[model samples]
Every structure is written in structure tokens, then in C-alpha cells.
Target chain A: MVHVGANPGRSGHRLSAQAARIVFDTRQGLAELFGVSDSRQIVFTSNATAGLNIALHGMLGPRDHVVTTSMEHNSVMRPLRHLARERGVRITVVAADREGRVDPAAIREALEPKTRLVAINHGSNVVGCIQPIAQIKEAIGKVPLLVDAAQTAGSYPISIERDGIDLLAFSGHKSLLGPAGTGGLYVRPELDLPPLVRGGTGSRSESDQQPDFRPDKYESGTLNTCGIAGLGAGVRFILERGVETIHNHEMNLLDVFLERLRRIEGVVLYGPSSTEARLPTVSLNVEGKSPSQVGGLLDKRHDIMVRVGLHCAPDAHRTIGTFPDGTVRFSAGALNTTDEMEQAVAAVDEIARS
Target chain B: MSSGKHVVLAFDSIHDVIKAEKIIVRHGIWCDLIPTPRELSSDCGMSIECRTDDLPDLESLRENGALEWRDIHRPE
Candidate 1:
């Protein structure tokens, strides 16, 4: 923030150009991360919810049907809900198994003649089950697939072309290790979704209408350049470290945490039984204590930080049969070590006993 | 080499201009980023200033989908 603070794309000055370069590099970095050939297909947003909102609202119309899984967060749920009530859009939420796994064939069965979009989360923020995106895409045939990668973007290996993902929304804060308020959406080159909002794009000053372009079409206002710079650096670090290496490290941490938690009495774990099919996120509840109680104790006494309750995905909690009361969710990242996981497990054990 | 002749390539956005500039430099061609001339276009952003002789290379870049230019200006 100290230097290169000029508003990007607004002027021709060196500092402004520098700021624009920062934004460009971020787009390129995200493109590289997601295996997008053209970086222009990626557009910056305030968060993943903003990106999802754009992809959903821009593409879907009245009488259009959307098929989404039960493991989706409110980011996907709320927009679909609004479209259903306001725009007369139809929604069919395919139920996932108790472990939060959605069958690919079920997605095919759920398809309708009016189905315009199939929205699903790449990973569950609450239960951590990773979806089979390619299989789901194959099942849906020609319909467009929108994957919300808010929980899996940086942590998992995702290639838009290889995975057959038409639209992907991701969060920079969760697994990308970027600052808050930095996220993006990737629009497949073949797809044309209108902008959520339109204004000055620093280009086409002569035209009052919104410029029909890749990024400038979606990104209307001034971007969070400072946040994007940090996001670019974070993506660079991930690239250097290798996403596979980071994934293995996180899974190892999850394995150790899971083993330790299983040994503790009165603790019931949720999500996939194995670590191979899930992220490092884990949800559990003590036999008798409420999630809030255990979460509060973990914070106050043990100084261990973990999110508690619905996590904004009541449907996910409902899928795992932890709705209303919710679960104590623990999410580990690349920086977390096995030692820290052990400490967290010990804290959970104590909380379980209490 | 002092050839007074120059070709101006204006793009729809600064992103394309910067991308084209990088590609031109990578191809070992000479180019300068200057403010888009008002006569060429109303875009207040930047544009590419290159030698007229490098038009062939810019054409090849555009043909390969590597560059996108809205308009070209050549001195009479």
C-alpha cells in the first residue's frame, strides 16, 4: 500500500501502469493456478460469493432450471433462492449421501429439459468432501457446469478444461492464502455471461454502454489492487511449493488429526471416513455437549481456533445430520504442522471430556 | 536506426496493449507504449508505437491470436 497506490486502468502514468500490472499479474497467476489458457477469462470480485452471484445471475433467466447439490454453501444457495423467487427460476437440489457425497448418476437423473445450469461445490466447507466434477460433467452432457471452488481452489488440483468446468468461482482467503476480499470467477471462453454491474472500465471512454470484453465486462468498479497484489504473491508461493506437495502435507496433517480424534471418547467425526476423498477440513461433535460449548471451550481454555455452528451452509450440516446444533469445524492449511494438529486434538479431547 | 516513420496500434484495453507489448518485445521487435492518440481512438488508455517495418510481425501475432488491435495508424 505504501507504493504503487495509483488507481489502475484509470490513467496512463507509470504508477497507474504499475498498479495495472499488479492486477494483470494476479489474473495471470489465477489463470495459471486454474489451468486457463487465457488470463482475460478471469475476473476479480470482492469474494467468492460475488463471483458466484455474477455467474448465476448473469447466466440464468426466468423458467431456467438449476441443479445443485445439497453440500453447497449459502453463496450458491442464496443466489439460486433469489432467482427462484424473483426471476421464476426452478431449482432441484440433488441430495448427497449422509457422508456428503453426491452421485454423478443422480445428477444425470436430476436433469430436466429446462435445466440451464448445474451448480455444485468442489469441496464442502463444513464436511470437506471433494466432489467428482469430471464425472458430474460427463453425466450432465451438454448443460453448463458451475463449480464453486471456495473451499478447494488453491488446495486442490483443478483444471477448467480438463475437468470440463464451464464456470468456476473461487475464494482467495481460504486455501489461496490471499488476503480477504480477493477472489475471482473464470468464464469459459465459449460462454458469454453478462456483467453483474457496468461502469467505467478505463477503456472505451467514448461509449456509454458497457464494453463487451472479458474482464472489464464483469469487473465494473475499482478493484482491490492491494489485496490482489497479496493474492498474486500467495499464488506465486503456492506455485513454487507445488499444489500437490501442499495437498499431501495437509492430508497428512488431517490423517494425524483424525487418528488422534478417533481415540478420544465421546467425539463423533463427520464427512468422508478416509482422507483421500476430502480436504483438511473436519467436523465433529462431542457426545453430549453442544458445538458452541465445545467451540467456546476450545477457544477460551485451549486457545485453539476453529469455527463452530452452521458455517453458513445449513444444508451441509443437514446432510451430515448436524443441523441446527452444527459441528465444531477444524480446517488445517499448508502452514499447519502435525505438532499443531496434535495440540488441537488434545484440546478437543479435553473439551470432549469436559 | 532513425526511421521517422512509426505505426500506432490502438487496442480496446490496456490489458491487450500490455500483452501485445510483451509479445512484441519477446519477438525482438522494437515498440513503445504511448498514450492513445485522440485521432486514432477515444480510449484514454495506452497504445503501442512501433516501426512501420514491424507491421508484418504484428500481423503474424494477430493472426496467431496472440495480439488484438482495434485500429492501426500509419504516417502518410
Candidate 2:
């Protein structure tokens, strides 16, 4: 495909009219994907981190208290920590099980009357363990729920309204297959969030004051129009492929990889042993081998791309007993193939033997 | 595809197409946006096509800062 701008905001005169239509249709498609109403509830951001910041800053104040889990990416954890340290907002981090899963009952026990928000990651980026968000939401009662869906948005089915999620943050690049610098937050229409950024949205040009709306309220300055434009294309691609098929393919690959990893004598896997309860992302360390060493061998020797280190989630690493040194991460996508997984398994087996 | 008429629109940027789409849809018009057809000029790679009768809606779109308007079937 030619590299066309997916950006509806900056297509200018050539596509001045149609660009807007594309974005509208794209939002409708996304709303259907998430089983939500009114595309207006979705606000575009530069990335998932930006969406998290918007949700965190918009919903909570100095006197509020927040509840989160240890398996969060820095996008969620760092902002909450900052809020606690600087603004005097109170936060409680519920610990996760060794498999990196947060028990919903633990979260319920951590809640207080002053709790304003409950933030949780839908899936652990390090171990790929999926959280029990529905149960957590049930336990939260009236408190608002924010789900960090960076690793699970397109890879799995997420229904914001049906699941009782007040806010959701996702990245376009990871599984949505769009360019970087594109992501969004889905805020339920009822919650009134403060504007995170203030400037031109081209909608309220007549007034000096910024428009108090879902997207325009948060979206300030010129948007990453080109990135979002590509995101439209990426979203269309995923919709056409069907989310269920994609999930099945990923789980099948994970199944094969996990079975092979288990057969290897010295390899130690993290997270749930079964593919049924986790994403396709697998983290593991071979006996007598550092994660970086195995990662380098996989890349230099086998020409395979994998992520190593804390995966920007130190708490998740700590929860799974892989902290400090981290572990090799293999995140499968819709485009990943079974043969590739076999090759990856073979490479790991050889490395473990060495 | 012949049952429905298609109109090709060119945009200088992606933002314009996105904005224009929202305006037209609110008026109950349906349109499809695709990578700018290759037979058309290659300046940009996205276009919109919808029923030809929606031309008046096009004027409203232009009033809202939409700049380019072209009939896809116009003879080259």
C-alpha cells in the first residue's frame, strides 16, 4: 500500500472534505469494536501514555484517593506516583499474584470511601497475564475505572460500556498496527473530565476560550494528523480481519511456543502456563543465561526481533520474580505465523543447550 | 458498484477529509473513503466517494473550509 496520510485533520484542500468523513467513519468503526455508543466519547491522543495522563489528571484532584495494581506500565504507575508525591493525592497499590494476576477481591479490600479512581492494566506487558477487569469493576462500586489497554486493545475484545469501564487508554502502534504517536482514550459521556490541554480545535474558532468537549477539550495544538490517518487504515485492517480470528491465531502461536519452552530442560517460563488465560506475549529466562544475552543471541544469530529488559514494568517484573535482570519477551501479533514461532522456539532451545 | 454512484475527492491533507466526513454524515449522507485512486493524480493517496445528488451538501462542506471539489467522472 502507498503511504497515504491517515490524518483527517491536516489533509488540507485536496481532501479537506473527505478527511473529516474518514475520521468519522473510523471512530464509528472503533466504537463498534469496543461496543460503545457515540463516537464523541473517544478522544484522540499522541499515544497511550498521553491518554493515561489525560485520564489521571482530568479525573482526580488533590483530595482524592486512587487504587492501582503492581502490574501497570509506567504510563499508569508513574503518573499516580507523581500525583501522590506532588499533589498529596493518596494511592494504594494492590499486589499481584506470582502469576502476575491481580485478584479483584484484593482491589476491593484496598478501596476506601475517598477513592476517586481505580486504574488497572488489562494485560501485563511483561508476562502477558490478563486481569479480571469485570470482577474488579464489580468490586469498585461507584468509583471510576480506568483500564490501560496498551497491549490488549486490538489484540483482544474490549467493551467499554458493557464492562463498566469509565475510561480506557490504548496505543495505535502496538496491536492496532498503526504508526507510532497515535492512541486514544474512551471516556464514558457521563463523567465530566477537565481539559488537559487548551488551544485551537478548529471547531470553536469564534471564541477565545477552548471548547469544553470530549476530543477538543483534550486535543490541543495541531494533532498528529498523519499518524492518526495511518491509524484509521490500521483500524480498518483489524476490523476486516475480525478480532476473534486474530485472538485465536495469537493464542495458537502462544500455545505452541509455551509447550516447546516447557519441554526445554533449562528454560523457565513466567505467567499462566495455559494460553487460555493470557495474551500471546511470553516472558522467560534460560538457566545460566541473562535475558539480554539470550535476546542478543536471538537477534544476531537468528535475525529475530524480541524485547528484553524490564519492559518498562518493574513492578510486574517484581511480582513475577523476574525483576532487576528481566526476561526475554516474545509478543505475537496477527501477522506472526506458526512457523515463525517454531523457529523462535528452536532458537531458544539451542541457546539453552549452550 | 454500478448501482451506486461514486465521487472522487482530493485533499491536500488528511485532516480535511476527516472534518468533511463528519459534516456530511451529520446530514445523513453516506460516503466511502479509500486510498486516493492511482489513476487519479498521485499528490495524495485518499479520496471520498458518495452519491452525486449530495452535491448541495458539498457546498455546505465547502462553507465549513472544505476546499477541493471534483467530479470523479469528469472527462480528463
Candidate 3:
């Protein structure tokens, strides 16, 4: 299907004005999905990494303190590290539980008067544990909360306004089923943020100076229009399918995988065992087998796709006692089926036994 | 399809359209990348069409960042 929003700024002529309205409607739909008041609050980016960078660099400066969890993807961790190294920002990493879950009290204890931003990953990429963001926001009191929702956005229901999230970064490619390089940020209207990239926004093309706006300020150069359109299609697909149904489907798969893996001897699973407190992703290590070995075997022998290694969250792996070596990650999605999970379980059983 | 009269252009970056036109003319594909018209809703600002049969190779172009595809027909 032809994607929506593929010709955003350039669409003044090609499509009838009514077709263009679909783009606006898609943005509005996104706003409603995230529980934001205005669609203007949503700014599109090339990817979630860019959105995270924008949120980190735009809102932080020298001597500003930020609190984050150990389970963050590199999208959040790398930027904070850069800020600390170059801009003199202080960052405190709140430790997670043995199951890779971050406790709100731990985040509260890490906070200080200088803490300007409290950033956390909604769902861990390595262990699939879901952080208690509402509790963390409550503990933060007044600090602006920035959530990296790269793995959770379309897969789970989110309400940025209701949850007190000041900024949210999400990826369109993963759970959203959009094309890669499509992501966005939801910034609260009241926050004062510096522009990450400044250039022409098509609205005021004649003016050399950048427009002082939420999206135009952050979005520099031309956008990935086709990717955004695909993202819109993906989002609409998810909205129609229902986030709760997607969540249930993934959770059911997770339950089956966990139960099957737990029954096997010498197989170790990380993160919460219960489906209620986690995403559908599961990370596990088979005794006497490295993650790379298992991942290779699964792909080469079984034609199954799985991610292995640090999964870009070293601290999370460390929290779950899988650091350095990492674990094999099987991330279930709306497209995944019970048969696939069974096939994966059988593959794991074979690999573990051999 | 006209005999050797068509051209195909694939682009990863919109900026690559300039390069694609030069290469197409050099190889004699008789095609060029133009700013996407209103009828074609593609992500990038440019599209290429030399022949309808070139559509089968669209996935190859996608690997280079051509997120959308369109066919251009020159009015005889």
C-alpha cells in the first residue's frame, strides 16, 4: 500500500488537498495514541536514536544533572555519556533488580536538587523487563521525565500526558512494523528545549533563520517522507488491530516460551518470569553454549531470526547476571505466531541437548 | 517498451538524484530522476521510470533507500 506522509512538506501539489489531510490525521492519531493534547507536540526524526539525542542534547547543558536507569539502550546511554564527557553533565545510573527491573525508590534515592531530567527505558532490550515508569515519575516529583519507548510504543498502550512523561522517544521499525529510519519524539509544550538541528522547514522557506517551533526547530533538512508514511501506515495498522490484543498475543507467546525453557535443564532465563511485568522479548542462556553459538545455530539450522550479544544494554545484562557475554534474545511481535514460538522452543531444546 | 529507449534511476539519498541523471545519460538509459510529482506519493523527493518492466527491480532500489516506487510515462 502507498504509505501516508511520504510527501509531507512537498505535497502541496501532487495529491489532492484531501489526501494530504490523511497525513495530518495520522499525526493526530499518533497524538491520541500517546495521549498528548496536540499533534504539534510530536516531532518526527530519522530514528529513535536521533529522537533520543534530540531529547538529551536539547534539554541538557553543562552542569545539569540527569538520572537514568542501567537498562537503557545505547540510544539513551551513549548520548548521556557524551553529555557527561563534553558538557560536564552529571548522570546517576539507578540500578535495576536481579530481574533487570528498575525500582522507583532506587530512582528516587538517586535524585538530587540538581537533577534536571529523569530518563528511563520503558522496556529493556536485553531482558525485556518493563520499568515502573509511573512510580518513577511520582518519585521524581518535579523533574521532567524522558522515556525511551523504542521497544514498547506500538506494542503496549502508552499515555504520555497521563503518565507524566515530558518526553518520549520511539522507533517505528520494531514493534510498529514501519520502515526503518522512522521515529519520533513527543515533547511537552511547556518545556524549553534548544533546537538539535536548524534549517528550512518549508513553511517559511523564504526566511533564512530557522522557525521557532517544536518540529521545525528540531527537524533539520528534508524529512524521510516515505519512511514517515510507512510509519503512519504501521501505526494505523496497530491502532486497528488494538494494542491490547497485540500485547496479549505477545504475552501468550512469552508464557509458552518461558514455560518450555524453564522445563529444560541447564537453561537460564533472565528478567521477570511473569508476563504481566515484561514485554514479549525473552533473553536466555543455555549452559555450555555461548549466545553467538546458539544464535548462529538457530539461524543457520532452523532459519529463525534472533538477536544475540550485549543487545546494546550492558548494564541491563549485568543486572540480570548475563553481562559481558549477553544472552540470546527472542523478541515476539504482533506478527509472530504460536507455531513460531513452538518452533523456537523446539529449536532451543535441540540446541541445548546437543 | 521501446527498444533501449528507457532508463531506470534508483536513489538512496535525494541528493543522489543529480548523480543518477549523470550516470543514466552516460550509460544511455534515456532516463532522469525528477522531483516527485503530485501523483506519486513517495518518501524521497525524486522518482525514476524508464520502463514498466523495471518495476521488478524495485526491491534492489529499496536497499539503497528508495522508500517508494512510481512509474513515469512520457507522453507520445
- Candidate whose TM-score is highest: 1
Q: After superposition, how far is residue A197 of candidate 3 from its true place, in Å?
A: 0.7
TM-scores for the candidates: 0.96, 0.82, 0.80
C-alpha lDDT (0 to 100) for residue A125 of candidate 3: 84
Model 2 CA lDDT for position B31: 73
**Model 2 CA RMSD to the hidden true structure, in angstroms:** 8.1
Docking class of 1: medium
Better of 1 and 2 by lDDT: 1
Runs with alpha carbons beyond 4 Å of true place in candidate 1: B1-4, B42-44
The top-ranked prediction according to lDDT is 1
Worst 10 residues of 3 chain A by lDDT: A11-20
Q: What digit string (tens of lDDT, one per residue) describes model 1 on residues A1-354?
A: 469998877877778877877888888888888999889899999999999999999889998999998999999999899999999999999999999999999999999999999999999999899999999999998899999999998898989988889999998888899999999999998897888989988888888999888788887888899999999988998888988999999999999999989999999999999987789999999998998999889889989888999999999988999989899999999899999999999898887776
Stretches of candidate 2 off by over 4 Å are: A1-14, B1-76
- The runs of at least 3 residues in candidate 3 whose Cα sits more than 4 Å from the true structure, single-residue gaps closed, are A1-7, A16-22, B1-76
Cα interface RMSD of each candidate: 1.6, 10.2, 12.0
Per-candidate clashes come to 0, 33, 3
lDDT of 1 by residue, B2-72 (tens): 24488888887767777777788888999887767776766648777899888898899889987778888
